[model samples]
Target: MVDDTGQKQTPNTLEEPLDLNRLSLDEQIYVNMRNDREFQGRLHACDQHLNTILGDVEETVTTIEIDEETYGEMHTSTKWNTSMLFGQEDGFVLVAPSLRVG
Candidate 1:
C-alpha cells in the first residue's frame, strides 16, 4: 500500500492484541511520553518493565503557550536526533509502532 507521501509501504502482519515488545524488535517505533515528548526510532530492545533502547532516534518536544490578550493557545514543536537513547516505562504514555495519529 501507499502511504500519505505516495510511497509504497509494507503492511504490518501483527494481529490484534499485539505484543509491543516483540513487534518492536528491530523495527521503527513511535512512542508518546507524558511530558509532550514523542520519539521515533529503531527499537533495539525493551523489557517487560518498559525500559527501552532506541537507535537513530528522533525526539520531538511540544510546547503550548497561552496568549494573554486573545486567550488562545499556540503550539510549537522542536525536534532533535540522537544516535541512541533509553526510555523508562514510567515515562511512557503510549507505544505502538504501526499506529498513526488519525
Candidate 2:
C-alpha cells in the first residue's frame, strides 16, 4: 500500500505489522525520507556507516547524531542542494535521511 505519495510501500513480513498509526515519529520521518528521490540517494550512500540497523521490508528507523560542525557541513553539502530549494524561511525544519533498504 502507498501512502499519500505515489511511492509503493514495501510488503510487510509476518513479524511486521502493516500499520502506520503504530509507527513512531522517527519511523514516519524515515518513510517520508525514503519516498523522496534525492534523499533516498543520500541514504543509500550513508547506509554503510550506520550500525545496528534494523527493519523489515516495509519500514526501518535508525538513530544517528553528528557533531555540530559535521552537521553544518552536511547541510551545505552538494547532496543537500535539492533540499535547499524548498526554501529556509521556515524555522525548525525537520529532515530525515531516506531508507537504504538492502
Candidate 3:
C-alpha cells in the first residue's frame, strides 16, 4: 500500500496492542482516561506497560452533577493545557485509531 505522499506503506502487523503506541511515536494521539478525563497530545514515548509520555498536551475533564430538585444532570467540562505529561498504564481507558481488532 502507498500513502498519500506516494510512500510505500508497511503492513500494520501489530502483534500486540502496545505496538500501536510504537507506531504513534512523535505523532498526535488522543487518549481517553479514567474519571471522564481525556488527553490530546504528541506521543513522545511509551513502554510495554502502556505508560506514556506526551508533549503539548491538552487535557479535558468532565463532571456531572445531579440537580436535587430538578433531577437533571448538569455537565461541567474543564480544559487545561500543559507542556508535557506522563500517563500511567492503568489510568488509560482508551487510545486512538492506531489500535484495532479484526
TM, every model:
0.77, 0.16, 0.80
Off by over 4 Å in 2: 1-84
Worst 10 residues of 2 by lDDT: 43-52
Error of 2 at 7 (Å): 39
Q: Write out the backbone clash pairs for model 1.
A: none
- Candidate 2 residue 10 Cα shift, in angstroms, is 29
lDDT per residue for candidate 3 within 1-102, as digits (tens), equals 776687776766465788788888988899999879999999999998888999999999999999999999999999999999999989898888444447
Q: Could you give the candidate ranking by lDDT, starting with the highest?
A: 3, 1, 2
lDDT of 1 by residue, 24-66 (tens): 6888899999999999999999887888999999999999999
Please report the TM-score between candidate 2 and the true structure.
0.16
Better of 1 and 3 by lDDT: 3
Tell me how far the alpha carbon of residue 93 in candidate 3 is from the true structure, in angstroms, after superposition.
Answer: 0.9
As for model 2, its CA RMSD to the true structure in angstroms is 16.0
lDDT of 2 by residue, 36-65 (tens): 222221221112112112232232234345
In angstroms, give how far residue 99 of model 1 lies from its true place: 5.9
Q: Could you give the C-alpha RMSD of every candidate to the true structure, in order shown? A: 9.7, 16.0, 7.1
